[model samples]
Target: MYVATKGGERAIEAAHQWLAEERRGDRDVPELSIAQIREQMSLAVNRVMAEGSLYDPDLAALAIKQARGDLIEAIFLIRAYRTTLPRFGASLPVETGEMAITRRVSATFKDVPGGQVLGPTFDYTHRLLDFKLAAEGTTPEAQRKSADETPAPHILDLLDRDGLMEPLETSEDTPSDLTREPLEMPADRPLRLQALARGDEGFVLSLAYSTQRGYGRTHAFVGELRIGTCAVEMEIPELGFAVEIGEVELSECETVNQFTGSKTEPAQFTRGYGLVFGQNERKSISMSLVDRALRWEELGEDNTGAPAQDAEFVLYHCDNIQATGFLEHIKLPHYVDFQSELELIRRLRREAGAEEREAAE
Candidate 1:
């Protein structure tokens, strides 16, 4: 049985070999190149990168191919690979504010400073399956627009000028890296938001959906959702000035949620925030809602015992890697405990037999 297996190492290797053979069903057929995977199976790569918290498309593609198109498996590969790579130094926090925005939209505002650009999204597309993609050969579009050089403005800043929503000031303190560190309870706004962004999409979605269903309802509106590449810079000890290392794609979402305040405190609107590695709007949006819902305690509101309001609950359950690993590991050997139970049952039966003979005597 899969649960009684002892040689996990051998089983893993054999499974991988079989998977590799299955991945290339016909030996005569040409193999999939990393570039092809990167270009064609880009969505899978995107999800891996978003959840894995790594932005290397080539690595993501290879992981996807190696995992036989398993997205979560690809994520696990990325995470495992990331664990071994030596940490060269911390990069400066990417300035999303200064991000050369390809897409910027706000649901809470109309006629704002910089007009909303929908950019690349499937939101408007019909749910119909594209059978054309399954055709023998297809080259749909070569249309790709280069980004404009104009500076972009945030919609929330405009609202901040009007003094409607609570204005958040930028901080100079160094933020904690969730990947390198274990998450502590009672995390700050920034740390909590980071964890939720890279957290499991489905888990976050369910939690957010729960809030919307009146479990922890906070009237929510997508304040802004922006997607684009931002420069990652690092300060060189010798140079002192930071140098640009590279750029990574990101999806950042900010939500304006319902107001909560007492007579003593001013009625100020709260914010829910989500920021992810690659282009993942849904994950980011859901993260923001969950983030806001978790803020009940700090906002001086009574705990409604909502799933989202439970800090220990949301943070513990949000990660896909941890969740999947633990869940699937049940397939491995657990018979030591089972054997103990078996021995206990046998002893109980033997004791019952002896007691029966004594009673008869």
Candidate 2:
């Protein structure tokens, strides 16, 4: 006795019309231009680009406007649009060493080679609201410094000289793309990092926080966190050499974790790495912490059964789109299923009542 619900198409169309009207609240008010959003709401645009796995800021800004400033929806729009575009060839892996550094910091050492440049960070800012911003005004530009010509060497590289940090192996093996391929269980570090890079920022942040509260204690130190622009090089077949095709803003983080050494080997500090699109330092840091927590098994540490330590658990539930879809689907009509359950409950009650009457007789 199941009947499909009717008027779904008409209802959807009506809902979209209402949404469009709401999006343009008060026609007298000036509409937000794409260029305005791209400049003023650049942080929102950056988040959309980072999570969507795309680099086009202009497109991201347009998606934000189209979605009525809904970031998740903007990310979805960008992701959907990206799939339709043709891929010519894979670009070479970015060289972080050649990055034109903007912001760089290290918690392990106060004085590093890069001089701990705190560029455009809110770390020292007071949390109080700036009422001055309520009035229409232009921000004054701060004093500037001459750009440093020397490329700062990675802090981990210094530790590597003394063999204090675990040696990282360079491989020519290509990493798996989660978008193109199906995600398998017991995923490798590369796959886990890929999933985490595009994962929900808040979810990743909470999970990382949980580890610090002793769910999966990974005595971690911020080895180095850097934000900068790096050149994207692609190998030219005819020229037989790699050439810079473009440049992208990147946020990179490296965490130094406590080591677990065997009897045969000396104890050395383990490392966790995170690299993300745009200047998303919070996500990059969270990614590094979660990355380190997930590496417990490979590093010869026991599984503490922490949520962050479970690779399968973390990777499966981190996606906002998948989680949002499943969560929102509950709003759909389930009258037939509910009626069936109701019928079964009535039958069970009737049988029980009859048995009681017979026993009394």
Count of steric clashes across candidates, in order: 0, 0
**Per-model C-alpha lDDT, please?**
0.83, 0.89
Cα RMSDs, all models: 2.9, 1.7
lDDT of 2 at 88: 84
lDDT of 1 at 176: 85
Listed in order, each prediction's TM-score against the native is 0.90, 0.95
- TM-score, model 2 to reference: 0.95
Residue-wise C-alpha lDDT for candidate 2, range 153-206, written one tens digit per residue: 898898999999989967889989887787898899899999999999999999
lDDT of 1 by residue, 226-338 (tens): 98889999999999799999998888999998675766657777788888877788888899899889888777887888999888888888888898999999886677877
Off by over 4 Å in 1: 1-13, 142-144, 349-361
